[model samples]
Target chain A: MMAGSALRRLMAEYKQLTVNPPEGIIAGPINEDNFFEWEAFITGPEGTCFEGGIFPAKLVFPPDYPLSPPKMQFLCEMFHPNIYADGRVCISILHAPGDDPMGYETSAERWSPVQSVEKILLSVVSMLAEPNDESGANVDAAKMWREDREQFNKIAEEIVRKTLDLPPP
Target chain B: MADDASSSSGITGNTVENSINQDELIMKQQREIEKEISETIPLVGEIEELQTLEKEYNEDPIYLLKVKDLSSKYKSIRRTRPDGNCFFRAFSYAYLERLLTDKQEYDKFYEIAKNSKDILVALGFSQFTVEDFYETFMEVIQRVGEHAGSTPDLIETVRMELHDKFNKQGYSDYIVVYLRLITSGQLQTDQEFYQNFIEGPRTVTEFCRQEVEPMYKESDHIHIIALSNALKVCVRVKYMDRGEGSQVIAHDFPEGSTPLVHLLYRPGHYDILYA
Candidate 1:
């Protein structure tokens, strides 16, 4: 039952994305036949360290869709506090529905079935503009973000340059 | 083939694997059983009748003493599923139970609840998503009032509908979900009064977006107060945790009013507490 609903929701979201694409964000499934795995390209939000970069990423939705949040990871290298070294986004919205057992997040900032893909992308864009160093997934990046601004920008700029390269389509 | 593979690994290995799988299966079943217990058992245990809690430690002697004193005051509790929606569930149950005694309050609540859908929609919740919860919430309220008699009968009926789990998505959690949204909306709408209590860096809008809107996010003091204010009813939350006192700290929501709904909040969970 959830599978049917999840698939239907994905289709609707896909339609919305295609019809009215958010600026600096374009996302869709890699395969026409499969809706579960999607590929996305997000242009770095202007006025951020990641500006002028087109970051490629992957989103893999669980069978439950909105009920369970999808996993988002950058295909390109990422150097940010909230994004893990391996490129996974670590925003509170992606966390499962419940209180932060660790007390890092308010219950409301976490996932609910009502959140859509567009919202996730929007949050990702905002996260890029202002990485929440308080609860950083990448400890190194978080430390640099908080303590050494110049170093953080240099590394981010380098990564941004690398992400601008076109991966084979 | 699976059995053969395990058996060929040797008897001791097979036993270890079997035990591991057994433990996992047992834990999984325990979770399901716990859910069932919450759904079916309206009341968990009488205060005096129950034994020492399985999780409490000797390090918290003060808490134990408080528990002892708490049991002396409140005799019983009605357990709601600890599914993060416990606040709304316990509040609704306790509030309705209170409403049974007063027609004026019940009518007032009924009218507000009837019109709450529009407010929820205005707060940006999709009408399609909220319609069932709104209807069922109203239906449950109306059905209980067909003829208000004893509190026991009303509670049993409310438990039946609330715990119906017919559409676990719609009945069990969604109704609670909508109730929470209403409370959040009310809080934001009346930010002038609520802004004083909201903590952390998030603004009222951001707080509602992150904390109040999400389903299964446990409710806080703010949530309780906002919900009470939303429905124009006061709530008394009995803090039964290991606090500095022998008596369960009872705080009335909206600060100074006599409360209609009473709940027991014990660190991450909420349940109904009776006088």
Candidate 2:
């Protein structure tokens, strides 16, 4: 039932985010009998335009984990303004407090069960270093993050040099 | 809903169209949580004595004379389950239905609800799941302190053991996360009188780690004054919004005290009323 207490609360938040690892994050479970599919990586948040990137994401969780709220994405290529132009991640604590049928977040900034996964990956590295172009969900990256600031740091430094040129699993 | 995986637009493209749109957003969040656990409405109900407010309000005769003067100065209500943890389950079922007939506040809330599991295992919890939510909240206050001489068998044995352990979904989120971890360990061990009633830039340990150990985060006024000063009781509340007249403005939470749960808030629910 309740998918075994949502797999022992995602194995106690994947054993406290693998023994306290929150600086430029890095997560777990691509599989360990699937503690509901996770992945994460994130590093970016140094001196913005995603200095020295890393990205790569996924998450999933909800066979009712922390009573629902977990579906981050960004398996790369995440042009912000609340992420989704594919790589989902539409913030507000991973939505789901009345599953916002577009009443753009309000149930006290959504999600409950005291949100986790290291506070949703430190609120997605402080939402890729602050993006919230007032409710955009990638409206062309919130009109290039509010009208082209040097073409939004040259397309977030070309998706942080294509996430440090992939290749490290 | 598999967290809205419309990993559709910017490719990460079709892995069977993102597993059939994450199985239709996990069946629309499992039919909206099986329609909110099939509408759970009772925890302490059946006390509804009066209500003819012009036939339950056939369009306001001035809000049916303010619900006929608030049912002649409050007489009955007890509801407790709007599911946003209705003011801490109607203030822990009206403080164990008024200590099931007040034997000195049921022996001072059963000696701090039976040593509130060493105050949540000395503020660390996980001693076998907060000792199974402090042994089902001390077997529901020791079956209301062993039916303190029958207040209807201590409200029918704490309403059939709080409806069989709050309908058992991990023991109802370990009984509201063990009363929101004993109201966030007494509001972060009383952080300077609750950090000036936390208005902004949060800190009572980040509002008790995001609005008090968060099961169904709704209670406000700093979670009803940190759950009425962490179970010393006293609640009052009485608001009923859409204000300006109809004088039901109450308020009492440790200010000019008069304890004994009384809720009925109305703007974002909370029930139990009985005067």
Candidate 3:
């Protein structure tokens, strides 16, 4: 029953998105029949290693939505401190709702039903500019970032090149 | 005449008193039952009504809003129900299906769904693929509507077949293989071509490159970790946080960051990155 209602809500949001698009974010239907599954393109935030690079990703929504957040992963290989090798992202807003059980995060930082795609994309942009390395998903990447800033920049540049379909340096 | 009058009067009084007592007992019992019904009926009705609304307007947005209003109205009622919290999850699937089926007309549906962390994790499960969508649809109309189980194996089998093809292509990326299978239909020119294209490796690749490649490119290390973290956060936030141990440690780093160092902060302890 709620699923039907949530679906309708999603549809209404989709209608509005088509008419007015946000900057640095472009996304649409993955297929004609499925709205829950979409392909998205996010340009690397300006003045970042990912700048001018078009990154592709996927967003898959569950049947029982709004009560849950969508899972998004980049199809492109990226090197970042917060992302795991498996193509998963780690943003605070994407965290599940409520207090962190592990005593690692406060309740205020977790995900809520009110969080939107615009917010998520904006968070991603922020994530690129400044990653939260306190609890690292890609521990190695995080370590390298904290210990060796120069090497980290080189690796990131390689990723940017690859993302742009350029050969490795 | 005096003896007959006394006996008849006493007998009449006793019978009337007994009849009155019985009537009072019956009325009391009826009132209790009525009270119980009044309290429980609304909650059950809300659940039923929500389910009915889903069946009636599975794809209609306007009607769905009415259902949402009803949900809000009876928030307390649902809180009392055992599986009331599952409503968001249940609705997300229906909402997702609607969005997928009528993408052009219902783009906003995806946006709404994207808000829920739990829903996102469920959708990421391999079971919610496009092939499963078809299978689910057919099963619903098969006249034997057994709507109480997890996804059937038929769809999984197809995914397995597609996995074999991926191995042959020398592509080790699991996400790539998964996307190719789900979005296979988008590659076809018509409905007739969908079946053949989805099942065949050559066509699936062609379709994947055109449709899946661009999005795949955006999935950088940052996105991957964020996604994985989101999944964990959803589990922790939705399920574990309610448990005894509910703490999460999150660390963030800049892009192009590498994890290759050992930190020594204690007298004899150092944190080293494990390969």
Instruction: Calculate DockQ per candidate and list them.
Output: 0.17, 0.11, 0.01
Instruction: Tell me which of candidates 1 and 3 scores higher on lDDT.
Output: 1
lDDT tens per residue, model 2, B1-275: 45445545456435644565566678779867855773765544556664733476778666666666678788777665666677877777667767777778788877876776787667665454455456656776676677754667556766677656655565555557678778887887788988898887767876776666656667788778876787777788888666777766778897787868888787787887888
Q: Per-residue CA lDDT of candidate 1, range B152-252, in tens?
A: 76656754654454225534454576687788779878888878878866688777777777776678888877887788888888787755657878899
- TM-score ranking from best candidate downward: 1, 3, 2
State in Å the error of residue B270, model 1. Answer: 2.6
Model 3 lDDT on a 0 to 1 scale = 0.44
After superposition, candidate 2 runs with Cα above 4 Å error: A1-14, A19-24, A27-41, A44-91, A94-111, A122-132, A135-143, A146-150, A153-155, A158-169, B1-86, B89-91, B98-271
Pairwise TM-score winner, candidates 2 and 3: 3
Scored by CA lDDT, what does every candidate get?
0.73, 0.72, 0.44
i-RMS, each model, one decimal: 5.1, 9.3, 19.9
Model 1 lDDT, residue B102, Cα: 71
TM-score against truth, every candidate: 0.66, 0.34, 0.39
Which predicted model would earn the best TM-score?
A: 1
> Distance from true position, residue B67, model 1, in Å?
7.3
Best-performing candidate as measured by DockQ: 1
Q: Residues A14-89, candidate 3, lDDT per residue (tens digit)? A: 6545666678887766885887887778888888766877878887776655445677888898778778787787
Q: Weakest 10 consecutive residues, lDDT, candidate 1 chain B?
A: B42-51
